[model samples]
Target chain A: MNLSRTKIGAILAAPTVVYMVIFFVVPSLILFSYSFWSSESYRVVPDFVFTNYLDSLHSAVFWKVTINAVRIGLTTAAISLVLAVPVGYYLVYVSRSQTMLYLILITWFSSYLVRIYAWRTLLGTNGVLNAVLLQLGIVDHPVDAFLFSSFAVTITLVHIYLPFCILLVTSSLSEIKPDLIDAARDLGTSSLGAFFRVIAPNAANGLAGAFMLTFILVAGDYVTPQMLGGSSGQTTGLLIADQFRKTGNWPLGAAQAFVMFVISIALYFILVSLGRATGLIVKRRTINPKGI
Target chain B: MRKIWSTEDILQLHLSRRVFLGGATALAGGVALGPFLPGSAHAAGGDLQIMAWEGWELSDELADWRTKNGVNVEVSAIGNQDDVTSKFSSGNPPPFDAAEYNQGYSDLYIDVLKITKPLDKAKIPNYSKENLFDVFYDKPTWYRDGKLHGVPYAWGLNALVYAPDKVEKPASYTDLLKPEFKGKIAIVDDTLATWPLAATLAGFGSKFPHLTKDEMASTFENLVKYRDQARVISLTYGDAVSLMVSGEVVAVLIGWTGIPVETAKQGLKTEYTIPKEGATTWCDAWFMPPSVDNEETSYKFINEAISPEIQAKVVTRNAAGVVSSKAVELLPPETKALFDYSDVNGIFKAAPLLGIPPLKSAEHATYADWVAAWNEFKAG
Candidate 1:
């Protein structure tokens, strides 16, 4: 009744493979095919033409929105990673109790819509923060800049996805051996230097993973931006949604979405490459430093 | 059409309409409450699934119907009219028996998808053409090939709503830019809601929903003033209501008629007004999907929905005007005041209503352009 390595591997991978084929690959192929079609009035014509893509390319707003999408995605990922690394480090290296870690993780349990609306309540001009500020004499008037701006959307997104980032980074940091850090420090390396030489290189994969995940999530989001981004929150996702919903132009929406998908993949590789280069620097510093 | 009629005319006209609703109500009530008829082709009991906006069910009425008829009536709140198209276009055999969407979406529902059957005239004997306002009942806009495919169930105006204590009575959309109202205004974050009203205020009342790009650009240029004053571009009806309830905004542009009703429940006194330039209006309709099962039940429910009792509940509780002309007679004085309906002509004069723009047609700027312009406007 013993299974071979290959057979076991196949058995383990079979479910995921089936799931992706049915859920991801099939829908993606359909979406890709739709990108090549055109819409006459509200009805989608399945004719293969480059009109949708051509139209998207010709429009300046598409490019502007696409660029804004990437900018916001990258910004959100960078901020989330920056904030997450410290928390991840503390949880893995300093914190002894699982209670604190679980408390932080529990934040994710709240509904996404509730979390977004909570931010809406907090940052609104007449919201709690403004009232408190006014009462405390911090400001004479309620600040209008706190909500319905890109600032509000970014801050909300960072809070929403921070738990996931911390989880990923902590998972990677936990895999590092305590002996490796002790060894580096024992070799005349400073705590900071050892961290750069040993810890950061080991944690690069998790950091990159968090970055990519946060980027994709933030970039494709329409609700957060639509709700909070009063005037400045027009992302490619919103435009794409408008196509399907407001315009009834499914083909154009599909085309816009695929274009973004391609951009996101390209940005992900660039992040990966940047991670590799950083890892190489750390490796060279620890193993083949010019001064050492 | 511009001439105003006397109150007597409305009372006289409403009498016949009330009689029709009374007869239909009795017939529907008998069928619903009585034991199942032996020769009926469609069975009486089954799930009646509906996709609609919030407050469509009128809980008391639904609970009463369910108790009497032994049928489960389930309603799922849809976000917008586009969700209706998504449900239909995903594939044939729509998920629900019926859907509630804007009357103007008939082009997409009836002409484009053909998922709707031409409504059976005999099935909904309560529906009277004279009961509905002319702006919404015009079939060339809502129907194709002269076949009626939907029944207007709910109607409301998109206008400026203001907090009376916080701001002066806003007589026009231009007051959104008053220095005193600065940073205390919210506008709807929608192209259809924003642009039509903006165009009208920019002195393009007759040309609204058909504005040229130059005209739209100029209108948006004017909109920038209001945008500067606005605290938020509310994304939905709830968003607008929240802005008022939270005291984030003293006034809202493109506010739905229901906003004041919701704010009042929150203990905030607010007023909705169609400005001097005019206001835009929308209608929610119920149409059976192509794959509708329990067809008999759907028809019966549609008929019952327009009955005097249900229509009264819809107007008072839900803050919507009933399509049935007779529903006005059944409404309490306070409920009637909410709609500003002293008479039928007053109801008709609520606004120089704007219809849904032809997004799919080439006669106007494409939907993409309108949205893009909004983004650009917001960006600035």
Candidate 2:
């Protein structure tokens, strides 16, 4: 018997589709349903109510933490991508050895908590950074601002996610042939101009995907921020986690999570639109049948 | 031999492979579900399962007792009070024979959720009026409805932890706000531990853990002052210890008694003091859930938990107060110096073990409200 390409593709994807439906889609739907419920005395009651969402919206603390999370997320993503693109370019276009990439991947073997604590030791008042500054007479005393601030949170996040972002960027750039960059340069485009005019627009979708993935991880991270962000580092993820862990208000936590999820989707769209508007992303043109 | 196999031979091979796969899958499923089966250890009361704080497992302390009793014990470390509550309330609850609940959470576990049942004091030989300190005996938190619901095991204080080298012993909580302590203080983000101190600072020490809405607001308003002085809001007791050890802050406002012990391990000397505004205290007790399977083993475990030898070991390791009066004689010099065993009643009067805010209240603030207030303070 003969089968169409689409049919073959569907058959190949069936297992993954079923797995996702069972594991992801069903759990997500249940969590979504829980957002509409209410809680009293640590017990979640099954009832349709919008009080959780409305209360979160009206609360000043909620807005404050949400905005703080967004700021940290966007800043970390921007820094990670900016730093990743150069290393990714070197690995894809300039280097033939896979050693550097292997080294980058090797960093993941270390525990995440260990990395966070390492950053704490490096940025603490009497840390290596302060010791160096003091030796060089950069300042009279250690800078307290080096840690337990939004800056510390963002810097630590950038370090943690940079390798991941670099891998994503390299994978995206590899799909664009180095020959395309050479051709652009031959047409009188400088190295920087070639990167912008030829490579970026072609790899726009992949780049945006990498940024959004990093942003979502950073924004939803409660642990790093709690460890480094101090009072200013309070984020929506921590608040939602507290609702479930401390307050036993699962429904309210679910509502806040869904709200953050919706915001993340909106941010993704906004980023894609901005890329197109700024000509960083090229639009595809279709041929008219009448003209043809 | 380069011989072509017949169709029947191929079909027979496929049938054998299918049978092997089916049998393996069934075996795996049975192994995974064995614990929940009726004849399994969990159901047959052959093993005792406990949910408790990390150190409360008493694996090292109870080794001999467990061996003598020929009992297999399983312990699950809990991150917070709600862990046990969430586990028991879930659709398929674990068969937890025993669990630990803080003093304040007894009401929620016993009265509201009904997750716990009255303990059979007759079975626990070590849990008695003569063995336990008078302060922990016949308490309203654990003893309710004319029945003992929990056995008091360990207790601790939430006071101001300070580095003696950098700062002198603060005479009052207000000293934390002095110019000398600027950028040298940390307030822990613990609502339950902070509430009593906040109440004291708000001039409502006598009515703590049960405050009207206006009083709750005043309590947090005072907490905000401490927050302003704090260089950072430590997320946990460990975080507070890290801050103190690193010398990032000279003092921790509303810190744990265990913080000094933790920091001392890192070569940092820190001490805690109950200021004029007083401090908050917590007592942990062992209780059996209603779904307990091995009641006999569970009672033995709870009784052994407060035994003099076991209590001494636990108090030393945890840097906490022991409920067993006899345990004091077995404590080491440094462990004995942690708390004044001679004046157990005086220590209770200085910082009483307070309850969590009422779960539901019309004229007063509830636990949920206190959580929200704590979150707001942390956000700032």
Candidate 3:
């Protein structure tokens, strides 16, 4: 019952490779092919044409919404990471409590829709926050600006995604040995200096992963933006969904999706480059967590 | 001699492996793609499949029907109106025997997709006998090319729903912009219902469903004020209900009758009022998709849907307006009070009907144009 090295490798990779090819690669290729097609009379016509892309490029709304989506994504990711790092660092380094971390992460077990609606209740004009603010005399009147805006969308997304970011950063931080920090301390470096030089670079992989995951999730999310974002917060995700769900304009939707995909990839590389330049990540070195 | 592999031999091995993988992938793809390949309609036989909007299925009646007839009815609750027409048009064997679509989408369902089939009068005697609302029977919207493509099911209006305690009953759509309602109002996020209602109140009712660019701009100009005064633009009946129940939104401009009915059930003092300028009424109807596999069952389901018993149940459970006049008789006194049936002769007069116009009707703007204008309004 011996297997060759190639056979063993194939067996180990088969499930993932097959799954990706079936679900991701195949659907993506179909979507790519559709991007070049056209729709007439609410039917997807299988003509290899450039009209959809041309129309998307020409439409001012398309670009505005696309840029809006990216802006939200970047803002959400940065804020989530900034807010999560300290919490994650505290849990791992100071508290050393995985139980508390798990408890925080467990809040996500509730439905996403429920969470979004909960935010709506808390942020609406006559909502809990407004009531509290008014009663405390912090505001003379209930604030209409609290909900149904881009700010509400961003705030809710940050709150929803913060736990995930914390979990990712905590996983990364836990791998750092205390002796490494002690060694850095023994070398006459301050705690902040040791954190920057020894800790941050090693946690770069997890940070990058967390940022990308949050950014992509926030950008592609249609429900939160539609529910909380209201009129002001409409994003390209809603447009794409409308094409499929309401308009039956698959080709144009596919093209818009591809455009967003291209923009996301470009932004990802830019972030990676920035990370590298800032000395947060070093080139040609595996981020071995145990030591340098 | 020990065998040594040449580049050609290695290439051949790699090619063989790749070919095997490719074949497996192709087989998997073919199996997946088989269900979606389009085909012609066939007569529906035994198992009944229905696709309808949420709360339109009349589940208790369906269970009773299932018990008596020994037929299984599978219902898919659609989220959007476009879903009804486009779903059967796309799927092979066409997923549902019948679908419930808004009459507003008749152009897409009957004219564009041509997916709806002529109802067999023999199977549905109740519809043929005009037992339903007079407005629905043989109407051009439901009846086209001498074929009865649809039968009216349930109808409702997107009107003003307000908490009577917090706000006085809104008399007009223009009440949305009142100084009192500033920062206390909400509106639904439906362009079709909201636009016409707005246009009517703005003294442009005659120009509705076909407003000129200037007309649309003016209508939206009025709407911008409403939008500014609003707390949130609700996406669904449930969203509005949640807002009303939580005391977040004291009033909603485009709130559905169903929302107040729901909120009232939750013990909120919510009341729906048709504004001075008539609210837009939308109706859902049962129509057979082209690929019906259970024609007998579909017709039976439609017949049962409009029957007094089922209609009363649906009205009570879903708070929907039934098409059948007989159903109004069967309704409990409390339920009957919810709907105004006094204007038996004037269903359209009570609430202005909005649907796709006939192909010959000259219109300055299409639904797409209206959507664009709405999007501009929303974007602002």
Candidate 4:
């Protein structure tokens, strides 16, 4: 049985493993190697130097923007998840809303570029929102004070990522035995208290997954911020883009990317640990010791 | 009202689901490997491919040739010079034979790859002594040493394309860069072509014969001041058109051939203006590939492209990209009058900014330094 299980796992995993080695691992290694190389105006010269790492770390602009990116990431993740949980719940639960739920899922089908372009049109100075407002006499001229600001960037990012958060939470909610939450109230815990003590813990794993999914999507995005961000709102992604295109500084771009990678990995582990401590992932060996 | 966690709370979901965890891990692994494999074998004598901006945007002649030659040619229309320069310099194996470039960018490639093969004077026989303007035909922009490095492919002016609403006087570059237009302006990003005109505006061009380093320094300073007042620095004609249509920018520094004519039908309030300092004029060449060895086919491609009939069709169908003298005769009597086909007489004579061609290498380095410095200055 053990041998059969091992064989099954390897057979299932071989394609992904081989695909990754060729596409991902090899390229990342090349980038890492180049990060240590010296870059001229447009060409890379292979001389070993730690200066790239030092330069990447030393820039206050780099660090400030990184922190701002993190702040935006957290705020976007939290707000998207917070809103998605209920909207998904209502669709999945009260709407008994399988049809609406399926319709909402259709949002995930639209291509990302179309969605970004649509959002840009809606939120731009002359976009659908401001255009309507002006026609309604709600405001006189176009209100650019809101468009292309960080608020607009974050709000648009949240709107884009909300569907992912809701889907993750609802799928995890689907797994819970509703009987346990009913029993807690059946034992005379108040409805709200039972939700807190019993049901919330049961669905913790889904929330963790939702957070991770939404967080990762917002972090690496280059388009929404690029189109929407005016002078004040440029991100590290834009800087990396300039390095490769405008400045032709690939080594520096690589080093800066590696820095982002380390931060993302660190954040990932922190979230994983916090999830475990909170029983977001209750050591599930007890729940499915043999079946899984 | 709700007793259960209600499928709605992200704060109450599980982690480490089987399929999603697996998908995330797999996706991350796939994205890490980049597009090109930097192996030794792939690097050697690789087919020199270019990604030009307007293979699709321009006329069908490029594709027509591919059919005739029976040699496979792959082309993608990346409609902007930023995309062109980025792709070429990006160290990617871009997919094309040659790209259409302006005088502004021909030097960038020369600086980077030096990958040009001189146009064989014998092969491109239509390249007569009398075809182009005297200054260029006597010594074309791409003419170096004794060999011609590029064929004259296209030419245009960086004249002002202004909205009649924005400017009462559209006759000078200095008038456009005023305080009232702080955030409502557009200009070309090329420093070499624009700076000599700025030097002329600052009266440095007149004093250059008795050239003083301090005078050149002041000219540079005045140009930097001009640079600061403009809001948008566009890299392509398409970008200029977009900004103009969006009403985001009022006046565009456009090549005369592209705007006030090529795109006026699109309902943009457009007029091409010659600055009081004259047009910052330029020319482009059909630069040859050092690695390209199909000499007979290459010559055929050049001669056929610049034939009188084809050149005339190009003036109507495409902008004035085809370089041939006979293109003038083919235009309607009235339309032809609008353009001066005398290469030197048309633009080169009308507004001559007589200034030094600062050493290309020194200019490239100094401008690059200035750009970086300007970015920092602007950020503040």
Candidate 5:
């Protein structure tokens, strides 16, 4: 007898189930456990100690850095999402040329290190940006601010996540029925009105998805802050790294990571609730004259 | 289900000679490939790889001794002795077979019982009475219960470096810490190094690492004053040198070993000083580790390194440090003028090797605090 469909489904899903268990679920649980313990020399004690948690919460610096991390994450998500929406729509709908869209996406395929390094060269003290400004007589001296500002970090993050946002929004836009556009046009709606009312609502889910992913990536990154933030760029992530590496204090690092994880989870849930509320209001629209 | 064979099944199929031959061949190949992989028995050697100050690499004469003795030796050359210590503390087993202790510092807790095994002088003939001077040789800190544990390697004074054109005639070590030269100066970020210079300038070096609360307060005041003018507290000797060379920063406190040579070669008209207040000098010595398997070869390497030919080579490669009794004769006259052995005026040396407190164990927090304090200082 042939294997049942349910059995086949289980067989196909076995790889994913194993994947999550081995890489995601297990490591996170282990890391969670480590956060509760103390390390005296290099030796780790398994006892639960809340001192690390207390230290992170009590310090004004921790709070300051956490707020900065949130600001960075949200700013990155907003910029990447806003910039991606237009590009993705244009690629999927406005442009009929397959070669152009493919050419556009090919840009994202380069290594991230190469992109960051290029940006570094451009913004460096004696870099292209400064050189150009000097030539134009825009400023008297080389601009160290371009490389070592919070602005560089936000710009770089937006650049890194823009492709992801486009990929997400493009896929969502692809899911919209072509007939819906035709139906809206048949009802005498303008192309812009149809897009804002119909296509955007369908793609709201993708926008939320992109925001969620980008926020996590931006919040956890330490290198961008270190390289671009200068002395002022001391982020919570860099502090967490310091605790583990130089301080040889694993418990403290783990605790800080745990707090960050908790904050990220809370933000995710808050965004989800807000999205649900907005999505409900959008789905209630009765503007369509002849609903099927 | 497909059938799987266990050990019992394999034994039961012992009649298959072709399969047995294939298994035997595979096992032999694995054995042959073993030595080529990391952590293999043959890859495990008795030779200990040492990362050390530039003075420790090789003597010009000992290239013959090393080749003839059929012993493998690998040396990683570095500028500052503290850098070698930093690597050892950074996990992944200690870096080398043996490191030279900062002269007279063989007794420090970091080196003594923890990293190095004490030496028996009877085994190594080159460790004679005359080579190590009275200041280092007579130090009981280098000896445990009156036995020499390490062979004195190379020692030098770290001094004030300034561009002659800019500074004119700066007097004492105190001149570098002044506000007028602030942003125009570079300093080695030793965390505690400025303590000797700062303390001495603040009238407290004689009470180093042991100070009355009042003295500590004065030192802190001086440090806060010094901190005001500095642009950046660069963390490495290389960084200090770079900032100085690029003219982004002109004068720096630097290790005498490699940098003064660079200063001379650049024709920068820079001066390295020993102030009237007195200076600190330090020496590094070769130490034996308990892990050393062939003491005979190790002893030979040590003895050959200190002999006149190699000592002279060490001096040549390292501009300031004197590795052996005869190393002074090898130096060019101008380089000799830059640093002197007898002068303690402007040069600040390494702390005495032994009997000092091990630098605070959980000192990373101290660094973090410094960064925070520095940021506040800069903001102000």
Candidate 6:
């Protein structure tokens, strides 16, 4: 008639565990297995082979797009997090009303493609920005660099993912009590000093998680880059998708995907370590039950 | 110490567990059997299901036919031929009675995948040489191994489109490489349509649909030169139109005739021409899959697809060419001006509908190779 805490926890987690095992875990394992297989005439053959991986590694196009993806991902994540922090701080500590947060969330109701096209309209050669610049006589000719470049892709990605980053940042910042900031301020610390020494270190893990999540989404997005990145906008995600959709080479696509996955994992660890090295992430030590 | 439960409590617990287990089993069973259900199959009973291009549905055109036959039709629109191929090759394909494939994909669907069934000419009376243009008759892409595999419906050309106000009409694909047109041109990212045009530019036009690996590499190398002139690579025909309409690019390499019409709507006048180096053409056809449940209804649908009334509407709506000779008379002035119906054979000779690269070949580059090369070119 009574259950232990562990037993109750297991019972509560059973449905999610079963669902994930069936959907995510099983499919991921299958996809991993497929990376070692081979394809001929658009048909996948079950066999252990390193050709797909080796070929991708040796491919110039693969390396080119992978680097492009990383650049776009990192730049977009950094900008989104930077912009999100201020808004998140204002909402969590300074603001009383939830209207600002709701307005930020409302932007997501518009379609993703619509937002990308909206950026295109604002950044095009004859777009509003160019028209304003032309009217002001900023330059004689319209600038063609605004749209269909890595700049356009990054700007659009920042707009799309900023609200998501803000939500994460707000949630992280809320956990650090206002008393900590007031305490730091009372101890001769400025507002900026409190943010760096008291706030950032405490929310380091959540902030890193927010950054990495945004990075992964941006890197793996094929549609936005295809729409706005122009000739140089092609990324590993688009290349991998092309393998599956156009070439019908599942093994090659799977191999490229795993390579990107490994890169993302490595980047996450590197980011966390960098935070620690910069002293932005303070390490917590576990205490012994008895004196050592 | 164990707590004792009342008889009612035990019964309630047992009943709740049974109900949970029963619900879980039912959910799992439904998930497993969902695809094979009547409506899920898409072509249940006498209903006809087709996978086709976005505007190829001809819903309004075929409304009377549906009412007369008392048959319901369903169509799934696709963005590209790969959408259909991927579905059929996914191991558990949708139960589509009919599907459309471009000329380049006929060999793929019919020969490699073996997913198509030959048509009975007797069932489709509208799809005859007398009704349709003779230029579409007896092609190896549609008729293979002495059997009719596809019924040709709509056709179009992928050629050079330029703004008449900004630049003179290009006489050759190489004209795009001129210094004056630099940074004012774009190539649509459609490999199937662009590859043959690349071959034309590379001086291997005659050897297209059968390019050697060296020739394929040369073709892409030539395309990369055009990339230098291109300010951006448009992802779709709409993107290309947007570029021209916004004055971002004065010209587009390997653009569709429909681009000018689309741009015209936006108050931009553009023109498309088959240059001296020639253009690549596309012809879409309808074929019944081997899994067709209602062959008679499928045949009727395909028949109506190529009929004069339906063809005229679809061609005008899509800004594409019609297969039926009778449809030409029904076409509006703007739509009729898109192609030279009086010289249909000449147009075919100039920009013939070419097959895609072979799937597997010992002496030539395969479709996979072309895709890889195309990606490399795009990445630049």
Q: Name the candidate that leads on DockQ.
A: 6
- Tell me what TM-score chain A of model 5 achieves: 0.86
Query: What is the full ranking by DockQ, best candidate first?
Result: 6, 2, 1, 3, 4, 5
Residue A87 error, candidate 1, Å: 2.3
Query: What TM-score would candidate 2 get against the native?
Result: 0.89
Q: Tell me which residue pairs clash in candidate 1.
A: none
Which lDDT values do the candidates have, in the order given? 0.78, 0.87, 0.79, 0.62, 0.64, 0.88
The lDDT, on a scale of 0 to 1, for candidate 1 is 0.78
lDDT of 4 by residue, A1-292 (tens): 3568779999899999999999999999999998999777578889799888898798766776677667667778989988887776566445767777777778879887677657656765667888999999999998755554677778888878887787888887777666877788899999678766775676766776788778767877766654444443445665676667665678888898899888878987898788788765564545464666
Please provide, for model 4 over B1-380, each residue's C-alpha lDDT reduced to its tens digit, 9 standing for 90 to 100: 85566554433444435557788887776566533434321122222234344522224654565565554444456544456557666555344445555565555566554656666787676677655444556454566678877666555556677777755655677776777666566655454355556557778654432334455556666765655555445545665665566665678654455655545667766767677776666565565555554445555555555666666665565444335665677766534654566554656666542322322233233433433433332232
Lowest lDDT 10-mer window, candidate 1 chain B? B344-353
Question: What CAPRI class is candidate 3?
Answer: acceptable
Q: Write the per-residue lDDT of candidate 1 for residues B23-125, one digit (tens) a residue.
A: 8998898779655655464445688888877778655766777677778888877776677777777656665877787755666667667878777766776
Give the per-residue lDDT digits (tens) of candidate 5, residues A67-186: 777888888888988898888778877785677667767868988766765676777666788889999999999765676467887888788777777788778788787789889999
Our model 6 lands, by Cα RMSD against the true structure, at 9.3
Candidate 5 stretches with Cα past 4 Å from truth are A1-47, A61-128, A141-230, A245-247, A266-292, B1-113, B117-189, B192-228, B242-247, B251-320, B342-380
DockQ for all candidate structures vs. native: 0.40, 0.48, 0.27, 0.11, 0.09, 0.53
Say which candidate scores most in lDDT: 6
lDDT of 3 by residue, A1-292 (tens): 9999889999999999999999999999999999998876567788889888888788777777777788888899999999988998899789988788889899899999889988988997768999999999999987877787788999999988889888888888888888899999999999899889988887887788889988998899877877887676778887787777666778988998998888888888898899998878766466565677
Rate residue B156 of model 4 by lDDT: 51
True contacts kept of each: 0.63, 0.71, 0.50, 0.17, 0.00, 0.79
lDDT of 2 by residue, B1-380 (tens): 79698999899889989999999998898799876776443222258889888877999898887787688989899866767777876656578999998988888888877878898787788988889999888888898889999899899878888999888899998999899898789887666787787888888889987899899998888878888888888767787888888888999888877888888899999998888777777899998887788887888788889999999998899899999998899999988987788999998887777788987889889888888888888888
Clashing pairs in 2: none
Model 5, residue B148: distance off in Å is 6.5
Ranking by TM-score: 6, 2, 1, 3, 4, 5
- Of the two candidates 4 and 5, the one with more favorable TM-score, higher being better, is 4
Task: Write one digit per residue (lDDT tens) for candidate 3, span B1-380.
Answer: 99999999999999999999999998898778755765312222367888877777767767866777777878888866656645655646466888888778887788887888888766786784457777767778788878889888887767788899988888887776788887677777766677777787667877676666677678778878888887777776677788788777789887777776688789997988887776678888888877777777788788888887888888778776878887888888877876677774476775556774222224465555565566566665
Error of 3 at B277 (Å): 1.9
